[model samples]
Target: MNLDLLKRTRMYKGYNQYQMAEGIGLTRQTYNYKENGKSSFNSDELLRITTFLDLSFKEVNEIFFDNLISK
Candidate 1:
């Protein structure tokens, strides 16, 4: 699920999971599952997360699309 990417990126931005979740309009548990790779992110949530994290769409798309294609 590339949880490491999620965790590392968030940590690199100096945001805790709860804070990141709040920023992206997700519950802490839901966001945790996403970050921990226990659940898949819906398209809306994925867009929100990427935008909230200030990641370019292309960058987020690359990461997510790669994961999907690989699986």
Candidate 2:
């Protein structure tokens, strides 16, 4: 995952980690772990993030799937 892009986007949208966790029905620590790459985001969490961030399909692909595409 492109964590830097994700963090930047989250900040740009004016959401803190706690708010994002609430929005996505996760605990703050869970969100932090996922954000920091200690854990992965499930598809359901990804969907919630896309909706909460108001992200476009292209943005989702860039932030979540860029590594796969690069390979």
Candidate 3:
């Protein structure tokens, strides 16, 4: 997982992990795990993160889809 980007984005937005988690409808622990590179996010979580961060789909995809490819 792109944990660095997650942490960086949150900091860029002036949010703590707990606040970002709340904004994105995730538990703080779960969001911390993702930010710490200890877990992967499902699609729903991905959508929530993008929405909460006010990121365009292109930005979200570029940030999180570095390892994915079109089939």
Please report the candidate that would top lDDT against the real structure.
2
Off by over 4 Å in 3: 67-71
- Please write out the lDDT profile of model 2 over residues 1-71, one tens digit for every residue: 79889989999999999999999999999999999999999999999999999998778888999845532
In angstroms, the error of model 1 at 68 is 8.3
* TM-score winner: 2
Candidate 3 has an lDDT of 0.81
TM-score of each prediction: 0.78, 0.90, 0.80
RMSD of each: 3.5, 2.5, 2.5
Query: Scored by CA lDDT, what does every candidate get?
Result: 0.77, 0.92, 0.81
Clashing pairs in 3: none
Could you give me the TM-score of model 1 versus the true structure? 0.78
The Cα error of candidate 2 at residue 70, in Å, is 12
lDDT of 3 by residue, 1-71 (tens): 46787788779988998999898888999888888878888889888888888876556765788646444
In candidate 2, what residue range of length 10 has the lowest lDDT sum? 62-71
Candidates by lDDT, descending order:
2, 3, 1
